[model samples]
Target: MKKPTMTQTLLFILVIGIGLFYALKYGNKAKKDIAEFESKKETNTTTKEIIELKYFGEIDLNKTEEYIDVLTNINGNEISIDLNIIEETISKKTIQPTINFLENLHEIEKIAHKQVLSDFKNGNIVKDYIEHHIGEFNDDDLKSLGIKTTDSPKERKQKFLNKIYLKRIGFYPEEWDSLAIFDFTISRDLTQYLIVLSFDSNGKFVDIYTES
Candidate 1:
């Protein structure tokens, strides 16, 4: 085979050098774009949007998984809280309600229990009550409380729910025959609270009694 001329060799070298330069340039640009995207994502996670109570919508009361998750993560630390453990903790705090709001205590006890079971199955009871009772606070209210978020309204509301969850005081249980009534109170004070949640047997939320 004949050796290549100096001109041919020089041309080959020049082509290879140009290719390498373009490759390096492209690689650096791609890495910079990725880095910028990641930085924005981290900033978003660190500075979340403020959530308010008015945005409360349908909740999956049957799905305790998310509830346990928020309860554990309220500290801003990612922790896994087992459902069984949470239930046990709630049970320990369970007590009889100071006032039984049920009108027909004996009659409604069974009815309420049955209703709760049905609602849990239908995934509507807790959702309905929450829709009816959650606060009217808006974005302004959340800002006043020092809660900040860039998330959508629904996500904001969920964050607010989780935050308030950590302030839960205890569970109060009231009995009427076999029917069970439990009041889960959350507040800075044990006696008075921001909200009182009433649930029946089978861990179904029945009503919410709030203090104005």
Candidate 2:
């Protein structure tokens, strides 16, 4: 075999170096494009569907999983909340509603236990009669004051329904059932709330009574 001259070797080396540089640049660009394509594909694909009183739409449930990942950060297990009803309303509110309102309740309880206790005791709630009269609830029964259990057959659902409403609102008068339902509204100092006060197919609240 003939040994290559100095000039020939130098030119060959330069060509190989240029080829490697282009290969790396092209590989990186291809990777970026693949990432972008995957993100858009995930967003467009639908894996879930739900209906709400006001709005309903298909959602790509696991679409953003890649983008919004938690690294060694376990905040909490995913709670199965009715996202269809609350998602739009929560985004519109200055602060996310239900969770934020619950946070406020915690804060109030922290600062003034007496006031929180007084307010809670006097909290606006559904009348016991209404709750007991709800016919029947699938789950959730009033065990006692400020206590409810979601693991029961619960034939008489009226008072149970009322108690659940009361738990969400705080306290309500006995005559609240007689008055127009439009007057029923709940609020916390920190967050805006929208209580649908909805009923199930059997005229039961079905635990879908509260929204924020």
Candidate 3:
């Protein structure tokens, strides 16, 4: 064979150099892609494990759709917690804490009830209710309750407040229906109201409001 020229040798070296550069570049890119894929897989696996372990008996994935229905007994009353999970992915950070909360709902219910009562007495819930529905009470109803229609609004309001006593109708959990985790139905004898309490993922009270 004829000896290769210097020009041919230089061209061969150039081609080899270019090929090696691309090979190294593509090889690094592939390795980076694989690493990222593996990291995502590990993260997903960890999340799945947490959900499975933390919510083992609290929820059944097959039976759950938009929310998890947890039946609980409180003071001999069969109450259910409809924990919301609509448009949510089952994960520890999102759903597990709420499940944990519902697990000890019997105790939490007491705390929530106490807080609601305290708020009702100190807050504007009663005032607002009296303001909104006082007109609904006719002369006969007022007389029966010893409230005079001719009395000043303040006097009437005080009399109404005296007659008002909260009787808890039932505990309704409809986290799926609204932001509130627990909806405590309170009957003021003349009217019914809902004490809607919302909690964070960690079972801390976030908000409380009254609705009729």
Best by lDDT: 3
Candidate 1 pairs with clashing backbones: 48-148, 48-149, 49-148, 49-149, 49-150, 50-148, 50-149, 95-173, 96-173
Worst 10-residue lDDT window for candidate 3 reads 165-174
The total of clashing pairs for model 1 equals 9
Judge candidate 2 against the unseen true structure and give its global Cα lDDT, from 0 to 1: 0.33
User: Model 1, 207: alpha-carbon shift in Å?
Assistant: 7.3
- lDDT value, residue 129 of candidate 2: 26
Clash totals for all models, in order? Answer: 9, 13, 0
Local distance difference test scores for all models: 0.40, 0.33, 0.59
Per-residue CA lDDT of model 3 for 1-212, tens digit only, reads: 99999999999999999999999999999999999999998875532232342222544432345644555557665555544545434444444455566566567667766676566578876567666666876687678788886899889877766654323322122342233366654233555665566665455666777776
Clashing pairs in 3: none
Better of 1 and 2 by lDDT: 1
- Which runs of model 3 end up more than 4 angstroms from their true locations? 1-64, 68-72, 78-80, 130-180, 187-193
> What TM-score would candidate 2 get against the native?
0.27
1-212 in candidate 2: lDDT tens per residue?
99999999999999999999999999999999999999999977655523121111222322311111111211221211122222222222222232333234333222322322233345433333233323332223224322345434343333333332211222111122211111122213322433334322222222223244
| Per-residue lDDT value at 171 in model 3 | 18
Candidate 3 TM-score, C-alpha based: 0.47
Best by TM-score: 3
